[model samples]
Target: MNTPFPAIASSSEVRLPTGHHWLYGDLVLPESFSGLVLFAHGSGSGRHSARNRQVAQRLQQRGIATLLFDLLTVEEEHVDLQTREHRFDIPLLTRRMQDATLWAQSQPQLQHARIGYFGASTGSAAALIAAARLGSRISAVVSRGGRPDLAGPVALAAVTAPTLLIVGGADDVVLDLNEQALRVMQCEKELAVVPGATHLFEEPGTLEQVSALAGDWFAAHLSMEHAA
Candidate 1:
């Protein structure tokens, strides 16, 4: 039986508030979509990053839509990389994610879809903070080798979305932080450690495991029709 869905590679972009632009990504949508999974890349990686693209492709293949946007404008990225200040601006990035979520909700292609978030590294912190602020607007969240601890106690406690945290077994420091943060999260959450995977999950096959875990988590949580 042929699955009613689009293949990987199709993607686009949209302009957000303040002239910021977002790469509206993923393989194209089938007639109907289960939900939208927006990607929040790590501190150094942007939307076009190969690792993130691979994960997004995997999600898109599973009938999910994904958006990988450059959180900071090019100019901002340059400055942030130079000064390293804006990269840790979790509050600002959270607000931007919130703005992007609202913008996504208004789009014709995604208007009726439940929204989910996929965040990595510091971006995970921003995603959690944004979920806390947006409340029921977001249905699910997944963090890959993330630093959700950076979101702070208030945001961690306030998040209500079902969340999945995928960490590297070999990355001891981040794993500890993720464990500690998990205790603070009042939402439905789980932590999975990929054996032999490092902080980047750059080890062969590790990223695939992360992607599969993320896809399953999002599908189970976001596919449900609920009032938000």
Candidate 2:
């Protein structure tokens, strides 16, 4: 899809309704975006994550819109820091993600747009579970150094969207876990390993590679003609 590239257009900050709490989201849409991707930030990260924001920007360059939000509220995040409780809570994260997705779909601008997910770290598990439960509504999923294994076997097998799991080759344990999840997934999927990266992809240019890989994946799948 050829597009007139705009670094960014106007975006809005939305308060999404969740059963437990209201989640904050930053929704950015280019003037002529083809799709919308709701981002699920990793454990201990929020809408302000530099890594996710970078990737979201890259997606924007590819003509895709993005919703980067806080999975946990400020109070909950503070509590988690003391208790180490919420960050790894897959079910909690999954439910919040679904709420965010439904909210995006309800938006006038995004209603007709194809939707995808960009998840990192433990957020990947939540993304997978939500995508599985949503079935065809979700068009694609991209996991960056994610823990899809945390989503468990049932969710992995139930997912039908095209999935791409990008892992850091040097992050052996996580790489192994992603591989295991890959084996269980029945969906059209691919595993991309970024050499010389750690779990955080903190190495210079490593994150750029991740953003590029994700941009391509979302661009390829988030299209009206790409059937769910």
Model number with the top lDDT:
2
lDDT for each candidate structure? 0.85, 0.92
Error of 1 at 140 (Å): 0.3
The per-prediction tally of clashing pairs is: 0, 0
Model 2 Cα shift for residue 6 (angstroms): 2.9
- Model 2: weakest 10-residue lDDT segment is 1-10
- Candidate 1 ranges with C-alpha deviation above 4 Å: 1-10, 18-28, 225-228
On residues 91-170, what C-alpha lDDT tens digit does candidate 1 reach at each position? Answer: 87887788889888988878888899999999999999999999999999999999999999888999999999999999
**In the order shown, what is each candidate's alpha-carbon RMSD?**
2.6, 1.9
Model 1 C-alpha RMSD vs. true structure (Å) is: 2.6
Candidate 2 lDDT tens digits, 100-120: 999989988889999999999
